[model samples]
Every structure is written in C-alpha cells, then in structure tokens.
Target: MKRTDIDANVLIAAFQGEGEVCQRALRVLDDPDRKFVVSDYLRLEVLPKPTFHKKREEIEFMQAVFERAEHLDTSPTLTGRAYYGLEI
Candidate 1:
C-alpha cells in the first residue's frame, strides 16, 4: 500500500470543485492502494470554518475523510526536516 498524505486544497477540491479538478481529486482519494495519513493541521485548515458556518454537508464530507484515514501526530522537528531540510 502507498502511504499518502493529502493536502487540504485537494480535499477541498474533491468536496467542492467542478469538472476535471474535482474528478482528479476524487480519484486520488478513492484509490484502493492508498493509505491516507492525516494530521491535525489538515483538520484545522479545513474544518473549523465550515463547522462554524454550519455547512453540515461539507463538514460531514471532511469528517468522512478523517474517519477513513490514519491520524498522525505532527511535530515541529519532523515538519522542519521534511519541508525545510533542517537538521533537527
């Protein structure tokens, strides 16, 4: 299985985008070989605003993704090494 970490924008697009963009996003999300690893950062980025505004459908969609995915605890050191090439 391929371990994958989806971006917030891609998740949003899957939920709300149109045409090819939406199709591609959904395809990635639904791939059987994928094992999604998600972080609280992604939840924070995608969930609160929709929940606060009472967008129930959108919230449910995001929650469904969260439910099917593996939750990962992100650390500043790991993020720094991954994204910034920092020796930590």
Candidate 2:
C-alpha cells in the first residue's frame, strides 16, 4: 500500500461535502490502495479555528481523520524547508 499525506485543503473540501471538488476529495480518501498520513501541522491548520467557533460537525470530521490516519510529528526544520524552501 502507498502512504499518502492529505493536505489541509483536501481535508476541508471533504468535510464540506457535495460538488465536484468534494467528490474528488472523497475519492482520494476512499481509495483502498492508499494509507492516509497526517501531521501535527495538519491538525493545527484545520482544527483550531473550527474548534474555537464551535463548528461541531467540522471538528468531528477533522477529529475522525486524525484518529484514523497515521500521525506524523511536524518538525521546525522540516516545516521551514517545506514552507519557505529554507534549509533548516
């Protein structure tokens, strides 16, 4: 099986439901050939705002993904390299 990391946009799209983009996002998540990988950064990116606003359904959706997917820690060095293209 291939391990795939889902971006915050994709997770948001999936939670949103309906439309072509949502359909596509669901397809990627539902693919049995792939294993989902999630990072602490992803949780921070998607969870905090919804949680603060009390978007219960959205929070639940994000929580479900975090619970089921393989968790990976986000390091400062890796984040700098990934986001800013800096060697850290």
Candidate 3:
C-alpha cells in the first residue's frame, strides 16, 4: 500500500489485544516502507480515556508512531469533506 489511514478501532484493538486484526494491523505498521496517516480527529479518537491510567504511555506510543510516519493535520475544509465521506 502507498499509504494507510489508521482508525481508532485499529489502535484500540492493537493496544487492548482484542483480536487478531489488531495484531495484523500492528505488523503492517511495523513495515518501513508503509506510510501511516492519521488526522487530528483520529488523534482524538485513538487517545485512551484519562481514567485508563495509561494515558501517558498511550500518548508516547502514538507520538513515536507518528514520528516515523507522515502526519496530516486536519483542517476545517478537510474535516467537512471527510464528514461527507470524501477522501482528503
């Protein structure tokens, strides 16, 4: 894949060991050639709840992942389009 759009469910499953899908997603994430993309909405969505007690760790993990991949900040225009099921 040229680039992959990561969603909150994928991240949640990967972290929580909910299923094999998450494990597979993590493997794909480990690929050096693959580009991971996430919007600001995804950042908010993937972030663990404050009461989870692992907020710092989760944030660190997300930071490290983004540091290795391309980051696309969500703008108002893009957000609006995305809401209507359009690709950014």
Q: What would the per-residue lDDT of candidate 1 be over residues 17-86, giving only the tens digit for each residue?
A: 9999999999999999999999877877788678768888999999999999999888867554444421
Q: Backbone collision count in every prediction?
A: 0, 0, 0
lDDT of each structure? 0.85, 0.81, 0.66
Each model's TM-score, in the order given?
Answer: 0.81, 0.78, 0.64
Top of the candidates by lDDT:
1
In terms of TM-score, the best-performing candidate is 1
TM-score of 2: 0.78
Candidate 1 Cα errors over 4 Å, as ranges: 74-88
lDDT of 3 by residue, 60-88 (tens): 77666667767786688865654553221
In the predicted model 2, the residue pairs found to clash are: none
RMSD of each: 7.6, 6.5, 6.7
Q: After superposition, how far is residue 54 of candidate 3 from its true place, in Å?
A: 4.9
Segments of candidate 3 deviating more than 4 angstroms: 48-54, 76-88
The number of residue pairs in model 3 that clash at the backbone is: 0
Query: Model 2: per-residue lDDT, tens digit, 1-88?
Result: 9999989998889988679999999888889898899986787688767776778889888888788799887797866554452111
| Deviation from native of the Cα of residue 87 in model 1, angstroms | 37
Candidate achieving higher TM-score, 1 or 2 = 1
Residue 76 shift from truth in candidate 3, angstroms: 6.2
